[model samples]
Target: MKLKLIFLLTASILAFTGCNNFETLNTDPARSSETQPEFLLGNAEKRASDLLYDTYFNGRIGMELSQYWMGTDKTSDGRFLFTNDGLWSGMYAGPLMDLQEIQNYYDRHPEETNPNILAVSEILKSWIFHILTDVYVDIPYTQALKGDVIPQPVFDKGKDVYSALLVSLKKQIDVLSNPGTMAIRGDVVANGSAAQWVRIANALRMRIAMRMADAQPAEAKAIIEDAVKNTMVSVAQDAFFPYNVATVTNRFPYNDVDRPLVEFAVTSTLVTYLQSVNDPRLPIFARPDETNGKYIGKVYGTEANAPTMIGLSKPGVMAYSGSAKGYMITYAEVAFLKAEAAARGMAVGSASAEELYKEAVTASMTQWGVTDAKVVATYLEGVPYKGGTWKNVIGTQKWLALYMQGIQSWMERLRLDPKKPNGEVLFIPPASGSLDPEVTDVPKRLKYPSSSRAANAINSEQAAKSIGGDTQATKNWWDTL
Candidate 1:
């Protein structure tokens, strides 16, 4: 059944060649339109996870932008020239389209519609849209997924899209909150647990709220307060997609023989911070530098005199292993969100900012296998919250905890220090010399893909104008001081 489902999902995704005609092409007679909701849901989950893992989370640009890893090649991603073609297509043509198909199925067979399936689909849809808007800003939202019905969907403003997504998430939460006779199936991420789905929904809500902190303070505060009251309160509830080496296609993208060894190494920013604090996860995160037998990172974006691969730390097993889980959102991130909210004097939960911050650190350590009680305690004592402003303290630790999840790490860094031309406060290594003179700073957002421009030219142009300009340096609505 699982194999059959995977096949159907793959077939469905392949049927849609372009975003402009996804809906029409997806419903062709040759395609398996009779695919079950469970299968569609499972496929959407896997494809979405893979896109995040392969195209964004583990992608070179994201890692380099977040300063988690540096490219050893002369054409290092540190130069900041990038496009969003893979991401835009993956979300729209794969997960989002599959989700819409599932919705269509339920609509046609209303009696057979499982609330659990529908709710999960909605949650996944919200997640993909969140990534889309956060990365590109002002994307096609309400009118998208209609195919021939609305071939040229107008782009929605980033803030308006965010507002709509929060509402959609709430409706999904309501559906999941109520009991239903049918059980959720084909749930590779959360194992068909409605309770876990609820937690994920709430955790995602908290994330969106935090993103809106500077731009939409009152709304952010209210949403976060409610989210904290209901979200995942511990490490066990993290939403992660587990990969199976047995399934060749499902293996981690970086687990290949050549890529891990040749292309990547840990960045100086990450290694320096971990070493400064005597972080135990250093060994776990990176292999010892081959030449010196000590962990060392290559300077990010430097061209002339960068460290050679042999002298720098390569990604450890956790990063490059086929079995490494694709983390969607984690308990550690939730704790930090609550900590940040508390620091902002928002009513999140009973825990104080210091208390939540400590828990977040512990959760991150525990996730990375630093579980010894005494060791964790000692580490916590060393990094305890001091007196004054909590911004740097929370921001720096959050950056460390969100190592492999580069997309989120980039988003958090932008949120913490939005106005800075260079991320000086967050310790993001600046790009220089090799960087294009036209590119004055690290990109605030990705440019609309060439595919998007060709397929939906008018709408894309409007989107760019709405967000100030279409350039990478153009800041999104939420990325404000």
Candidate 2:
């Protein structure tokens, strides 16, 4: 009891006397610290790439919605069930947060921060927001990623988000054109090449411009003209984001066990269209059925009468492999944008619509390993471009080129072919028996995730109401087709 009293009296005296250095003494010297902004670059890139090509976002949600691949044993996604809201939650909390930190680092350490790195970071952030706004329509934009300062960010209108992104992209494009003293480090996407990022930024501008062309023609025309005048990604300079080897820790999501290709089969919509067009890429895009050694696709959303896994065709060997790269902004996509711009009577340099269309097709063929001149020429001959049917031609061809890129293809589809007054869509709808009566056609936009609603109820409710309800049928601001 005497020792306890002594200890208590000493501790009380120390607490009062040594409180000046308490924080320093209590701080753990071995605790992890924040990395330099450069180190965060690759992490942000990988996270965005994962969101683009991962099993949940791309495989289940994107590919299913775009009708590129359909579930074998599972059909909910193909039937327009977007239960996994990781596309929203994961992005805002994961990559977007990383990017925001990068910007914050620059803001805090302006003298130390490289302007080029900041430019790249802004470009990537814009890219991510572009995806988000397109998918969710009205998402947390202006007030997003503020951490505790604004725990619940108000959602920005989709049009306003697009406009802001375009302005930001234009500013960053100038910065990348004239980079800073420090060379970019840990750049897994472009090998620290500021030039490559310029192309990507311009491509993004073109994509956004095209998406908004129908709704905001004057603004879209200005952006499109500016991007086309600038240097765009060429066929030789395609941005195919790399994936690691076929390891358990690092592999393409389609080949990884978590969301293996075995769970999905080629959709009949894709197979039938490819076959009708005599597309040589059919074999390259889909593997022959294991049962009959024939390329047979499963009808999308055929829950009741879906074929067995071995009875249907899976993704091709190259595509299903672990090393297959994710498409960031392909040359083919850029060429298609140029072609569309030209076809729309917009001034886009010397190339005519037909010439650009052929180039775009060739670029896509080359991307999928079809490089033979004769084969490409033959394929082009099969689908000649017509000015009268330019929209259908470009839309169909772009969809085909964007075979595995689910979200991008879906966006293009929504933009190119708007839902008719009678609720008709140009793209294939899910099988009649498997569709939720509430959603009979292809989804226009993904509903805000339930988690988002739960966390930011008032903001989510307001955004949903502003964008014509939080449902798959609601069209985004850009999808005025």
Candidate 3:
């Protein structure tokens, strides 16, 4: 009892020293520590570390499975070791959960509202909602983050979520504009300031608004225009996270598994595109095979064909980077969005979609370390978007720009699929031998996490009744395009 008292006394001294600094200290929802503004900002940092992980899985995990990319695929489930659920809870539980909790804390302590927390939440929330929409189309949004106070939150129409995000992004951008917003105070990101936060928030708004192209083209145009009128002009303001081996959660484990259980490699389809374009990014994007010394690509489900040597997996095919970075919105993505919006007749700075396509391609190459001016010049030889349909113009430009970025790439294709979901896929990834690739197309949506169904059984039952079956194939609003 004396030791406990001593510990309490020490804490009180420190708390008292810091107490005067606080405008108003409040009781945190679950924390016994009297959280002042600094603590709340520190909490934002802790959450940012967690939020960084969201990019790898929700943003990028399922995306690899959807399209034919240069490297990695287990989502097919043919031979790729990862099961559907393995793909399900990849990173959502960690980061998404923490973000919700932080919001709850903020809600309880309104005085703690500062530029960093407000802006970070607004920007990251758009990302969270974007990932959820990509997977399920519609989800609980109008009533989200309510915790036990609201046990059963109805799913918002996907369109509604997009609208809500648009408002949040705009509001938060203004909050982060003040120089003193995070200055002379605690900070989450080391080099982050209020201006940087606004840039990211605005850029993300541009991306989100463009996502509504098909479902609400006119609305998409208005939002895009608002963004271009007030948008980011460089990659420095990019809202991205740096990843390293020690920061494993911030990186995608698909390409960095610890043991030798799952075996998948680069996709042949992507290899062909890289080679055909003679794109310099191929080297940076994919690692060469150590055995054959050839750039070998693997079929999604059939990663282990060493014995057969037909689209087989090799040990050193993929060049793993322990310190690789995760991408959020960047200049490359913005260019591509512009290209896409232009294709759909969304005017911005009077640049045509075709013009934007060329610019986007060049910008993307530059962002991926494609520096040599001559090499860049040569890579731009191909005619930009010779095809007329938005699918060919916007879709193809986006495909190249979104390499390894995640669900953003897959959604582009989903957006352009035939109105009735019947069309010829130009880049049909090498199919999972398990599924008769000719017959069954890749799924467009993921089933809900089994745990959610098991624990929230009552809610799950209602969801099933409302949405026909919570299967992996249910198309979300954007995917249903």
Candidate 4:
């Protein structure tokens, strides 16, 4: 009798739960979940989407600090690197915190198993792991985020983190492909649809695998092939978050800010690459330097007289415009990776590497609103063509797409064409902060945040001891390639 009563009450409330605020407070205690599993699932989906936007704050901002633009002034004591303490706070504190919680909750309950949340969380995990492994290089992971249960987390080597992420992603994608699907009540791309989320998950697998190129070429090639079969082969299938004017929640971060006053200016290396290739995407990606037509970027060490920009005084509104959701992965990036793999005779899809290379180049230009047939024709015509200049073709495209994003463009400068090294370098130098140049062919890795040394002294010391050579000069495990 009691069970019957509980079941009846639960069904009644689930019917009306949507009419009320999404909070489960109104739900009948005994039968709420059974009565309306979809409602709880819907609310969870909403929370997951919220997680994606927060990354734009942490990750996107770092990219901006990289070389896309110069800062208005020093962001951190390590101004040379535009070393924002916020990067850790934002990446670890925000996106990571929620992800760790959500994943654990998902693991225990295993209820929200649809592709959207699965893909979303899986992709989010990949990025979070990427950020930590790439920047901090051997920070906590193996025992990290065990939550209150296990407080002192052990720092796993970066290669371990990458391997673990790949395995986890591969498993989840397989389960998602033909398993009991979750109830997706909200607008969740990764979870809401199986095909799309699978695509994203596969793309992420390829990405992380590519990072392992130097350390585990065989493993990397296998993973890349696995991903290529199901991943982003064309722009129609890129995993992107598009910002809409109607939705202020999704607007691009730079929409309301004064572009010129923000202190971040376009860098010389970037401008030179853009101008050299005569890429039309330059005008679309950056505002013109009104003072002198030639792109004038300020060096990072400048104490005064910042570079000039046009419409500096112009008032701009945050009306539905230029802002887009942060990019998790793009078709161009995948294509470039394939091109590299092809150059090395790695496993990939049907097209010859050269064919894929041209496709990748055109896809990048198209994304930037460069619709001029002539420009497209010239880019394809290979006028900027220099023989054996694979770096010229692939590196520039990679850099161009990663604008305002952070070290990715600069990273290409380091990695592309590792065989025949080039004298060219790309980086966002330390501004009035570093005593001298990075002294590396490229900016290697960020300095450990000052707070790490002060606040988390004991644990950080252990990390520094374990990771070894934790300096800007220290090469990350993945960067070995």
Candidate 5:
């Protein structure tokens, strides 16, 4: 008993002593205090993919605007009634924030920064900002992502933003050309390959330059000439977000089991056009109607006289296989851009406009798993290039190639034919009866979020005015036509 009492008293004293420095002794060795740029880069990529490939934003809002698909149960988006505030806030607070953090880290620790990683970050940031300015017309670019430093960043003009982005992309191309020793880590899109990043950077520069072709002709011409001299993405090196079937979070948006399948159906406009041209991608794009043994698409945005859902074709099953790749940009699109540049008499190599156009169509067919040469030839013959109508031909083909990639398709429409000239516009507007009285045609840009207006009313109003009242019908700077 006496020995037991002494032992207990000694242990109590030791425990009291240990408590004095318990925090230092109990620290987790594996825990990291610093931000991991690698993990953050992957996260930023995923978030951007999610925003772009999301069922609501890309499908209902963008695809509907481009007339690729129409909402069945929910017709608001199809009617151009969507506010798109969530998309705006999501981009700024989500992926953009993550990317900004990565850049900020590198800027602060210049000694530890890798040129390859920095180049990758800049490329992605440009792409995201490209989408933003294209959608909103003008956004807080210069002072954006500064967190509390500039709470109410003034909205920059779309044209100015484009200029800055082009310069930044040019700088990145140089950085990537002579990459540093540090390897990119946690990369899900390009797998940490600097070669692939270089191609993407060059491709983006060309795309941006081409967008400014009409508005800033001389400058755009110079940029395109330089970009064409550099290496661009090949068909095998196309950028895509690879979704997996392992979990709800990783699965393709269309394949999300939690969401109902009957919310949308393929648009009749797309189905009819494909059928008219006898395009081989039709079957891959949509499934035959259930009641009728035919590919019958639903008329776009018709609520009063809307057809029953029983005989309407839904999007194809292959597209929602739970692992469909979320395409960011494709070789076909780049080829089409080259074709356009050539058509415009810009120096885009020795390939003629006709040859480039055919190549683009072939690339697009191949991308959609339709590589049969005879079928593609037949389709190309049906839609042969017309020198006098190169704009319509290229615009129409590009629109078709960008199916299901709604935002890109819609943006391309604005760029190609903002005025929606008769027989020239690439997109089909909603049925006359279905058209919302508030907007006369398909939306060209999304309005600023209400939250933005409420929180930063001065800046929001200034941006709205800068973009010509922030109405859906307002044209972006790139939509010069």
Candidate 6:
């Protein structure tokens, strides 16, 4: 099933590439062209969701790095044995290309173009690029997606990329805020709701702004303040793709029948922390140990030498099901961002940091379907903000709330401890003897893929030189402590 899905996605890419001159192809009787902006938008949406959810989130590499789960193998991701090839390819060849095609379609038919479709395309483009830049730091931005026009695109500085993305997101919001006929036919995520799109755009801006908190404080403050005033105000406004079991393209990839039953185990770092705080979200996050009928989590990076897995907890069915929704950005995340802003003396709505923090936690609980009032109330009472160490407190809870959305969680961990002497944050523990001796700590950024080296050698070499070196230890502009 997974292979079939991959074939279909690959075929879609071929179809788009084969009809590069879509306008001319549209007039030819023998060639089929995707001239409709709605179709292009739909395809872009699905491709983006698949890359973000299936390739990144569901892949569990980020989860292992973030210490949310532990692998059972010796050379597993818990020991930092992973690569960014899947992510690099998915972002560049799949969604990024499709989004660029949407822009190309808009450029060809300016008068006939739907404003909402163009706006959504811009939002998604920013979304995919944001993920790309966050993970790899420096990436092709200005000259990216130009195909033959600029086959060897130079990598832009991470900060410059963020600046450009912020400008793009703001433009999308301005276009979406006004009253117009939103093209909803191909929008699987928000159903073409202009209001929802605006909310998502603002939320995305907030996320990018927070990513710049350490490196670009003034800009981050301004962008975050504006986002707080305009972004998703409630859980109902969260941007997410609802996966359906019947839709092969939209189904969660981890739900495949051939997948291993014990592919991942709840990490001791996560379960122990939750248990210490008596977090009600634990049972919802992981199944009880089969042997002791209690929650048991394995130590990170020690899965290979760990004792029998008869009692270890695995991720629950809902956590890895085909019907699980893929979140682009959520109100809870926005709330937490606002909380952090408030803690930093930035005005984010009428609520104080404590108020926003509690609200964020509740919103996350609600999103996970944990509606028991007592359970929520108890958890809240147990984990109230202690006033000091705001970064650690908020960062820890945010990490917990961002389960399954692994990449974002890892990014947050980075932001929280941008320049730690040891690359460990609140929820993610320090790397011990699990990693290779040469790897001193958690990686700051991914090396450029081998494909980039072979295909775009000159530009790739320039990028590597500009960003220190093409190694995991090289820190991006935003990694400044």
How accurate locally, in lDDT, is each candidate? 0.82, 0.83, 0.58, 0.58, 0.82, 0.78
Question: 1-481 in candidate 4: lDDT tens per residue?
Answer: 9999999999889867766765666777776243133343333333333443333333234443345544434433224344345455455555566556555555666764345454455555666677667777776677666647765566677778888888888877886677455543343334366667677788778777776787788999888877888877677776555555566655554454333334445555456656766767666655555655545554543455332334221111221144654566778888888887776678687787778777777787766666677778787775332336665556656666665445455445445532211435445455555532543233455655676566556776776766665566667776664
Error of 3 at 437 (Å): 11
RMSD of 6: 9.5
Candidate 3 CA-lDDT value: 0.58
Candidate 5 accuracy as lDDT? 0.82
At residue 155, candidate 1 shows an lDDT of 95
Give the count of colliding residue pairs in each prediction: 0, 0, 5, 17, 0, 0
Clashing pairs in 1: none
Model 6, C-alpha of 209: deviation from truth (Å): 0.6
lDDT of 5 by residue, 1-481 (tens): 9999999999999999899979877887789666788888898898998888888898888888888788887787888888456888888998888888887887888887776777788789999999898888889899998867898889999999999999999898888787767798878889998878777877888888888888889998898888877655457878888888887788886774565477778888878877877878889999888887799887787663333567788888766678888887888898999999999999989999999999999998988898889989988988888767788889888988888788988888877762211254334557644355657667878889898898789999988987788788888887876
lDDT tens per residue, model 3, 1-481: 9999999999999889778856445545466654454444444444444443342443234445544442343333432222445333433444455556656666788776555565665566676677776666656677665656776566676678888888888887676665463552444442556666676676777877766666676787888877876665665655555555675654433445464422335566556666765777677666566556677666444434443333433323222444444566678778777777766666777877767777777777777777677876676665346535646655655676666565666666666642211223445533544343222455566666676577567766676656666665566654445
Whole-model alpha-carbon lDDT for candidate 6? 0.78
By summed lDDT, which 10 consecutive residues of candidate 3 come out lowest? Answer: 417-426
User: What is the C-alpha lDDT profile of model 1 across 1-481, one tens digit per residue?
Assistant: 9999999998887765566687875687777658889899899988888888884345676777788887775444677755335789878999899999988898899988888888888899998899899999999999999996998899999999899989988898898888477789888889998888888998999999899999999999999888777888778888898887778788866675344455777878788878877888999888887778998887777663443577788877788878888889999999999898999999876778999899999999989989998998888877777535588778888888898898888888788852211224445445454354455546788889898899899999998999988887788888884
Better of 4 and 5 by TM-score: 5
- Comparing 1 and 5 on TM-score, the stronger one: 5
Clashing pairs in 5: none
For each candidate, what TM-score against the reference? 0.89, 0.91, 0.77, 0.77, 0.91, 0.88
TM-score of 1: 0.89
- Candidate 3 regions exceeding 4 Å error are 1-63, 68-93, 106-110, 178-190, 244-262, 300-319, 387-390, 417-425, 429-439
Whose TM-score is higher: candidate 2's or candidate 6's? 2
Report the Cα lDDT for candidate 4.
Answer: 0.58
